[model samples]
Target: MAVTPGEETLGSRYRSLRDLVLEELRDQIIERRLAPGERLVERDLAEVLDVSRIVVREAIQQLAAEGMVTVLPRRGAQVAALDPDSALHLFEVRIGLESMAATAAAERRTDVDLARLDRLIVEAQEATRAGDRKRATHLNMEFHEAVVDAAGNPLLGSIFRSLSGRALQLFRIGQDVDAHGLHHEHVELVAVLRAGDAERAGAMMAEHIAGSREGTIERVRQLVAEAEAREARG
Candidate 1:
């Protein structure tokens, strides 16, 4: 059968549905609702998400491509086990990217950019003080996004956005550690940005990202230990 122009085909609709399912599943994985090494059954996820098994299968394939899930021929799929070495590499990339962004922003940021950053800081502070870890984490991303935007480099922004999903997963893993402490760090970064010191701002950004890397690595180790302990008991 020939499809008419401007009409959405079944394939397109299914692809769209699959993307939604993929996003939801990624959220669960990042939020630890689907913990590391946990099995992912297509039927079970399909039932829970109220979607078809086909969509779940497609979504799982996408997740596997993103390095978030592992699919075995006989074992089906499971959330990828935590790899501290890979996490360290990603954090290193982030440090380089964010530091460059901060440096560029210091040189290029306008009054409006500074104002927006100030507002974000205040809102993030409120979220932290109110004990809203989720909102605070979101605001933290927004704050870095604003910095990158201020840099006014489309290519830099594109690269940062590409790495953000895994970065966000790390954020969610460490969300409970110290919202207030992180907010204060943001305050420091803002001050450097406000001073328009390119070198200092870049250094601050690198140091800030480096600070979080250890915590995330520790969390990964803890998860692995817990899993191992469970296996030993079993």
Candidate 2:
């Protein structure tokens, strides 16, 4: 069945305008084009996307449910701000879920799954080498998501997807400073997964996520300090 541009088949009908809008907004958030605390005005978005206000509202609500935005009583929706505590909390939960998923994936991975992950990791490495931070970050996400899918656990996979959405915002911000280091971490993770050592793979996944969280916190703190210093000088 051929899928139309706006209309997918019955099996894929869920990929509607709302999903499209959500992805567009998500990309903005990930690239920091829509910075934290930026208000998402429904009328503005509708005009920007050439979609109806209903579509914009639904997309904003989905983002809000994913913790990427907050809908205030009268102030409307705005991008959620990241802080050290929230970053740490998200990583703590993600570490447990992702580590277990990687372990299970390693134990049950098929050749096809392994090949896909390898391709993703290689693409990420190439992107990093080319200084394509956005592409590198996206491929890095795809690699981990492929691992979760290989685990063959729907519930766990859903949780990982949700966490990844939130984490990607902070991850992108941190990538401005540590893109190369993050690329190295992806290389190490792929190596562990390919080795089929579930225990070691799981441990490596946990450590990688935790290290990212710590690095993000430190970077945010540094930013805060610099801003404060500038304020004091003024």
lDDT of 2 by residue, 181-221 (tens): 77677777777777789999899889888876767888767
**lDDT of all predictions, in order shown?**
0.82, 0.78
Candidate 1 is scored at a TM of 0.80
State the local distance difference test value for candidate 1. 0.82
lDDT of 1 by residue, 1-234 (tens): 011123432334455788777877787787777877789888777666666899889988878877789998899899988878878988999899999999999999989989998999899888878888777777788888899989999999988876776778888777766766787888888888888899999999999889888888888788789889998999
Residue 106 of candidate 1: its Cα lDDT?
Answer: 90
TM-score of 2: 0.84
Please provide TM-scores, in order, for all candidate models, with all chains considered together: 0.80, 0.84
In model 2, residue pairs whose N, Cα or C atoms come closer than 3 Å (at least 3 residues apart or on different chains), thus clashing, are: none
Q: How many backbone clashes can be found in candidate 1?
A: 0
Candidate 2, lDDT over the whole model: 0.78
Using lDDT as the measure, which candidate wins? 1
RMSD of each: 7.0, 6.1
